[model samples]
Target: MSPAFRLGGLELQRFARARLTRAALVAVVLIPLLYSGLYLWSFWNPQGNIGNIPVALVVLDDGDLGRELADNLIDRQIFAWKETDPADAEKGVQEGTYYGSLTIPADFTANLKSPSKDGPPQPAYLQVHVDQGKSYLFETIAKAVFAEVQATVGKSAISDYLDRIFVSFGKLHDSTLKAARGADQLADGAGDARSGAGRLQDGLGTARQGTAKLSDGLRTAGTGASTLAQGLGSAKKGADDLLSGAYKLHRGAGTLTQGLVTAKDGTSKLAAGAVKLDQGAAKLAAGNAEAFQQVDRFRPVINQLADQAVPFLRSHTGDIRQLAEFVNVAASFLADCLADLPARIQADRVKADKAYKALKTYLDTHPDLDPQLRTLLEAAEKAAKRLAELADWLDALVGEHLADLKQLERDALGVARLARQLANLAPRLAGLIDQARDKFNELDNGLAKLADGAAKLHQGTGEAVKGATKLDAGMTKLVDGASKLDTGLGALVAGANKLDIGLGKLTGGANKLNAGLGQLGQGAGSLDSG
Candidate 1:
């Protein structure tokens, strides 16, 4: 026997003596056996559902959007929902009755349309709270499942919108087709009406009779027209004579006008030139006279100005720098004198007063008639009083020094600062000098290269300028040639006009023959009428 089985058998035997122990052992074995049997029964005859999983569903919203969404979840058969208040669902999750709770806020619909970055919409946020210590993994699965459901719902909403838009688009298409057919029908009806109108116009006998009367009038008109044609023929002959004369006169008049315009342009240019020459001569004369006058007048005035300026510059010359230097030196001396004096004087006065009090106390305390001691005591008293007086004098000196020292210290510091400034400026000046040296080197190199490059550029530019000059001359020649061509074309047009006038005479003769034929016909008709 295996050790494990033997051990288990011993454990079973140990408790076999007591009836209750024996029954419990049997129950332990039989419980598994009963469970196996029940499991087999379940396998053979399966139930589609488990007991309603204690799933809490909470909708914080009262709106139709939340209601519809929650109902969809129920319809999907994901779970048997334990409809509960939001707070109670949390409690149930703690109690282990519910696997998890789903909460929807009041603005769930609005959030579906316009959601925050972290929540809802594509990511499909649902507040799913579970007792993580017990059912955290299940809650995670539920979140994933719900996420898929949300995507499906979003797609469904889109499909609904597409369906509605498609339906509307179909109706619009039909309406448009109907309208187009109606317009076609209207066009056909207009064609039919047009055909009817043509027949009506043709069948009107009164209108035809009126047209026949117009034809009779036209026949009468033909007699008068023949006479008019003869008169027009004579007029055309006269016009041709007049036009031929005008052609000759117009050619002479155009030449005269061209000469006149040229003369006027030349006269205008000559007048402008004369005016320019007169103005130049007047200006030259005035300029020379003014120059001479200015030279004579300015000499004395300049000398006087120099004399006056020399005295003025000399007058203030020493005062500015000398006074500033003197003041600066004096200020430095005063500052050195007053450095520690004010603090010393005040302290000394205080000490002297203290000394006086001490000496008086000693004198009052001792009444011994030792003259040396008494004299020594009196001397100390006088010395203390004198020190006090000295202190006052020192204090007065301190006040004077304080005033002078301020200006003096300022001047000394300014001088010292100037020295330091000069020290600071030395390195900057050196840097500037270095920069200048570099710039000079660059300038030399650049100028040498520039001179070489400029030589080449200048040669190229000269060649280009020469080419341009040639092109300009060629353009001028082309313009002159074009002007000559225009003149030739004008002459050709005049010759062509002469031919047209000759042809017009022939046409007039033909017109005369046609008029005579018309007259003969008219006379025949008149004879018939008689």
Candidate 2:
């Protein structure tokens, strides 16, 4: 410490004596201080230096999209913006009047607005012209800032395009939901139609079976009527023979009475003639009694038919009528639905086609779209076209089948009417048979009285002749009643024949209804799947 202090004092005394050395040391110290002070003064407020970094902003876009990008760069305040045309900006950058220039192209908006899915998107670039001869800090800062601005602008444009596309997608989703709801409604309607058709088919099946039974019963009744008519004809002929025999007997009685007064020798011949006439009357009475018994046998058959027919009508007719009414109502509803289906389908087809066409136009205009997005759009367009075709086909199918449903409804009403007629006919036939039985019993009693009177002719031959006259009148009345019965049976047979034909038509209509329902089910399924 002592040696170092002695050296420092000797050096200071030497430096103080020498003016050139002292001047040189003072100059050295002052030069460093002046240099450091000048640097500190120049760089003290670095933020204020931004105004000195002059940069040219050249906007060449035709629209606001480019102008917006230029404005954003200017507002960042990283550089001083110089108002310049494209040519002036290029010249300023090269001549060192501007550190750098950013020029936006004329087609910037058009390029930035386009979105593509098949390949890389077409990019709109911000042209950066930097003066390489300018200060390193100015050139580097301008480049870095412009690069960031370009990236930000590009991102903003892409975000805007993506937002617009997503809006269109949202609208498409809403339309798809509407279409789906329509399909669900159609499916519900079809399901209801299928259920109604199934019920109608079952009702028709029962009616068809009932009609077949009725036909068989009518045929049996026709056969029985024919048999009864033949028996009545035979009885009428027998009555004519009896009446003729009775007239002959009356003449014989007169002859016998006249002979009793004229000659006693003619008494044996008259008595023999009276006895023979009485024996013939007895034979006639026995034949008439057998014919009456045969006619009476039809009464139980008619009663049984009435019993069967009446209850069948009462139990089944109400149900049949109700089923027919239900079928008619269902058919009317189906007709209404089908009537509008073609028009609705046509409208749907038009909408689908319009949407598909729009998508196709967008795809045509945007060739450089992303591949995945392009594929999705293409698929959507194709699906829309297919839906249009399916809707058209469904429309045509409804138009073709509506008539069959109407016919089915008409046939159901006809069956209901026939059932009512059959109910009325049953009671009327039963009454007619009862009347015939009563008439035959009266004829049998008249024949018995004639036989009794003929046996007592020996006591009163004139009374026997009077009874024969009354018996002939009764035979005439019986023949007339039998002819009326034949007429009624012929009318019944004709009515049955008409009913058979109507039932056949009804069966055909039921089959058509089933077929039409099947077609409707298929159309509903197609709509749902699409």
Report the error of model 2 at residue 22, Å: 13
Count of backbone collisions within predicted model 1: 0
Model 1: residue 507 alpha-carbon error in angstroms: 99
Per-residue lDDT over 1-530 for candidate 2, one digit per residue giving the tens place of the 0 to 100 score = 69999987786686667664466455544554554454455345644576668888888787778777667667676678876896687557545688666666565676556443322233444555554333334334554554557455555644464322200000001223334455555545554543344344346556556655655555555555555545554554554345335433433433343333344334434555656676676666566566556655665675566667555655565565656566556655565665566578778878987988899999999999999999999999899888878877776776687576456545555554555554455445445545655665676666666655544553364455455545545544544444343344333333332332233223323333444445554554443343
**Which residue ranges in model 1 land beyond 4 Å of their true spot?**
1-17, 34-47, 61-64, 75-78, 96-99, 115-124, 129-530
Q: How many backbone clashes does every candidate have? A: 0, 9
Candidate 2, position 44, lDDT: 59
- The global C-alpha lDDT for each of the candidates, from Candidate 1 onward, is 0.54, 0.55
For each candidate, what TM-score against the reference?
Answer: 0.22, 0.22
TM-score result, candidate 2 = 0.22
| Whole-structure CA lDDT of model 1 | 0.54
> In candidate 2, which residue ranges exceed 4 Å CA deviation?
1-45, 49-52, 74-79, 132-136, 147-530
